[model samples]
Target: MSRNTTTHDEFSDRTILVTGSSRGIGAATAKELAERGGDVVVNYRTSEDRAEAVVDSITDAGGEAIAVQADVRDPDAVDELVATAESAFGTIDVLVNNANISFSRTPFLEHPWDEFRDKLVGEIRAAYNCTQAVTPGMLEHEYGRIVYVSSEATRTVRPGFSSHVVAKSALNGLARSVATELASEGVVANVISPGPVRTEASADVLEQFEDQLIAETPMGDLAEPRDVARTVALFASDDASFVTGTRTPVNGGLLVE
Candidate 1:
């Protein structure tokens, strides 16, 4: 493959996988890394067109990228997804565990049992599945970067976001543990905790509460998907080689951590 036509070729030899990248932060991250010269694998559970569009955006810009379909919550599917990407480019050196997770805003008692269980189990399972699938090769190569996309809600839980808080809160611990365990082996792990982002999925919520959110944030604005993407790329790049086990917030100053 030709080297990515960007200013820096640091990622020209790297292969990255960003799950749930059909849109939002994941899509922006995939594009960001590709632009930095990495061959990127865009993973999505559904939304083929959106995923392909992400790939196209990269390739059109003279970067290498491909879209793969996989439900990261399933180990088998993750295995297949990693294998396919590896076959196409090479072993994945950077795994951005940005799998899509949702908040079912209901009081704990009112939350449906199945939805609660699914959201909780599904989030952790997806990260676990992808991590297990790619880390073996990363170990063999002696280099890896794992970034988890978490939420600022974990810090100060919202009234109706018990499940979301629980799930996201787990990621902070998981990332730290992974970093402690793998840092010696040349693998670095970190978390990006973003606040209410202005994306299609959150448009309704933002439409109703954007004014209040902006007022509360010192930055007086919401985070764009690309804002979180840039921070994720930093963790994935050599720039943050010494930055591990951190839950860096990309919330436009909404929360000071």
Candidate 2:
């Protein structure tokens, strides 16, 4: 594990794939998992440099990781991603769906039909393809953990984010269905719905909504990416053995549900 491992080999001997891990929350999750003793595949569609940087950081800290480029929305690419990860680390035991979150800020009425459809389709398609590609291997091994990085926007309404919310909402259903159907197969699925997270690229967003979110949240600050990453690690850990088909909020107690 990396230097951050807290005396727990929580993910030892496990192989985890974190999609869109080149930056932000995804990168944090990849590093966190590696620190917890997982051999991680940092998957990215582009930003090879950033992806490599993530891998380098993990390895430099004595953790196992590799960077692989694959568009999770494409089934063929997802299949290849699974194969490559399995080739490197033997098999993937955990899958983190953190990509396909291109947010469009057009107002509901102004949103074009094609744009709306693409947003929803792209989001779900990526989940569908990755789930299909990884589950067979997971089932064959009789062990699997799938974590979807959803958004707090699904429940907390936000202007100009209708399509984004709708797409994220679909993941709730997907997580439920997958968890119910696969739990008996020794596989589990769940979600980590985060509120506005503070990341390197979120300055403009924070400038706009930080005060409002902080004022409403009991925790009084936006969650850092590591906070969400730690939750993802928890879901992927053996500690979450009895947890499945559930949505855990990492939103600083803003939406109490």
Candidate 3:
């Protein structure tokens, strides 16, 4: 699990748009796709410098990439983002919905109703906006891949994540629906639910629960961002042409069912 070692060139002529890809799993997936010869659009709501850095890294590695800023929750902005990517790369062949708000670790009883509604609406809206914007291009080409970044928490419940899990569960359902409706058109949709992954945002949580997490995980280790990214690359590649309406977990064998 080193970074950027994937040799799949299926995306050589494809363009991919990854939301919230300035850092974390999104960044890793963007780089992995670029390394595999896909032109990448790195989307971020803020963190312009970080997003630009990701673009620079891809270009330095001889891969094509550009950073675009758009709030995925806004339909108009998402349309603009897709338009920009299409303008730069001709057409977008893959859409990775990875942007999400961090969950607040509060007791279920103490969680505000408005906050929960906001979280659910925001997450679902972003996915809807991106999916709607990218489907027409995919339909025209008769080839597309939609990958939603979900969470294992939906299956393996944890305290203080009720709203987050609910939203992700809905997203999984959305992906499945997209798969059913678009499969005949040569477009595939799938979900990747990662376990506890080591990233900048999860550093503190990992540090606090490293022992507990490893003990629960049969693999005895946490997943790196690249671990999740590799799976995404597979789904986005032509190799997974028949693999649609599936949810693959990348959670180190934790909560196996």
Candidate 4:
């Protein structure tokens, strides 16, 4: 790494895993962590090509990274994914719970039963799986940071976003509970709720809601994936060791008004 690059020994010996990191917020957060000197494990459920691409980008930029595949909804797969990261980098230091699948917005009355199962099971189950998998490693070392990528929809309460909002809210609750349980063990957990990030995933859902979102947001601008990624990095960094058990909203100052 060059002098211009920061390979902070702060995390040089650590492995940071970001789930669903093939693209979007997960990809951005993986890159950010890698750039800061942590060995990165990029976990993807299906996007092998994109995951490898992210790995290559990190390696090219003088950082170490490897792509792991797992359906986070499956507990066994998540355990394997964590084992792969441990085998690659020795110890897991930071785990970003970013593996989320978006379901179409539909009124609760019109929402299909399958969508509920898919959205709820996918989001909440994955969080539980990944956290459980990496937690032992954190406890062994007596140091860890867990960052959960959540949504502002929990606060926004968008009409058609019932499932996602509910799932994210549950995720935040989980983080809070874990923070209290794990703080005594030197582990800190926090949730980042980003509003209207302009990622490919968000593009599909934002078109219909951008106007309403922007009008409601105090900053009057859409957030970029990088914006949310930065906050994830912050929460995972030593700077936030004292911060935990709370919801941090990065919605361009939205939800305040």
**Model 3, range 69-187, lDDT digits (tens) per residue?**
99999999999999999999977899999998766877899999988988899999999999999999999999999999999989878788889989999999999999999999999
In order of lDDT, best first, we have: 3, 2, 1, 4
Candidate 1: residue 90 lDDT (0-100): 95
lDDT of 4 by residue, 1-257 (tens): 11132344456777999999999999988988888888999999889999999999999999999999999988988878888888989879999999897787899999998997789878989999889988998999999999999988887786888999888888999999999999999999999988788898877678887898788877778887777887888899898999999788888777764
Which residue runs does candidate 3 get wrong by more than 4 Å? 1-5
Model 1: per-residue lDDT, tens digit, 35-83? 9899999999879999999999999999999999999998999999999
Each candidate's number of clashing pairs is 0, 0, 0, 0
lDDT of each: 0.89, 0.91, 0.92, 0.88
Clashes of 1: 0
Identify the leading candidate in terms of lDDT.
3
How well is each residue in 1-257 modelled by candidate 2, as lDDT tens digits?
Answer: 12253535789999999999999999999999998899999999989999999999999999999999999988999989999999999878999999965756899999998999988999999988998888998999899999999999899887998998999999889989999999998999999999888886667778987898899989778888898999999999889988999999998799995
Candidate 4 CA-lDDT value: 0.88
Off by over 4 Å in 1: 1-7
What TM-score does each of the candidates earn?
A: 0.95, 0.96, 0.97, 0.93
lDDT of 2 at 225: 88
Better of 1 and 3 by lDDT: 3
